[model samples]
Target: MKDKTNEISMKKKIKNKAFSLMAKKGLKDISMREIAEACGVTKPVLYYYFKDKEDLCYSLIVEKSVVSNENLKKFAASGASFEEILVFIFSEYMQDISHKDVFPFVIHVSSYLLSNPDLGKRFEVVKEQNFAVISGILEKEYKKGTITKKGKEMALQLIFANLAHLILNSCEHAIKFSPSYPKDMARAILKAIDYREK
Candidate 1:
């Protein structure tokens, strides 16, 4: 039991350090040795857990994305109104990101992922599965006519696209926009989906 706990703790430590390093150094440019040092572990220790750098990255992506998806599921089940849910998701997700710089780092990693089909597909599958969870909720709302006339496609597109934009704007773009932008955007997104204000 202690060993398992240590394993989980070590993985989390490595992930946090690697993510911070990647955010600053760019994912492709970071070396496994550097990641080891960042985690206070030897290169051989890293190798014992991760087959290679790509494998470690794949695990990171899978683990983080899964957590995001699970959070979405919990929010969906929380019985909050769609608008309330959107506000909470956007506000909380953006605020909870340990480092804003990781957004740009993610974009860099995504470009590399495309060239690696095996990892890319696994990544896509995780994304699609997560989206499906949101999609199911939207479908229910659409049937109830609680959402705007734009329907499922537009709602889904707007919700996720706006999320990406928020992250990028906050991270990559130099402009220091209003702190309220995320919540404001969230409200607007909901309004775009349904004209009737909740």
Candidate 2:
């Protein structure tokens, strides 16, 4: 039991260190040795926890995605209205981008995934699972005639594109947005999709 606990702790430490390093340096520039040294562990310790750099990177992506999907599921199950849920998700994303580590980490991971087709395909599967949860929520709105099927599809694209824009402009250009940005963006998206309240 103690060994397992220690193992979990060590793995968390290694991941956190690696995430920070990769965010700053990009995946191709970072090495397992550097991650091990950052974590104050030997190279062998990192290898014991992760088979290789790709394994560690993939694990990081999965860990974050799983937590995000779980939260989306919980929020969707909470019976919030579609507008409320959109605001909540946008707000959460805004908060995440505000963190120093998140934006760069997302960029690093995205660039890495683009270059690694196999890994990108695996990521797409995880992404689809998340989309399904959001789609389920959107389906409720569709059934009630608040949104058309085309509107539902556009809503998904608009929401994610908006988030990507926010992160990119905010991080790369150091742009700042008001506290009400999330709610404003949510309303804009709904308006763009011609959503009608039932």
Q: Compose the digit string of candidate 1's lDDT tens values, residues 1-198.
A: 999999999988988888778777866788999999999999999998888777787788778778877887788788877776677767765775436766766877887787777777767877787689778878878777776446667878887887676666666455555668667876787667653533
Clashes of 2: 0
lDDT of 1 at 25: 80
Candidate 2 global TM-score: 0.92
Assess the local accuracy of residue 97 in candidate 1 as a C-alpha lDDT between 0 and 100: 46
- Model 2 clash pairs are none
Among all windows of 10 consecutive residues in model 1, the one with the lowest summed lDDT is 189-198
Off by over 4 Å in 2: none
| Count: clashes, candidate 1 | 2
- How do all models score by TM-score? 0.84, 0.92
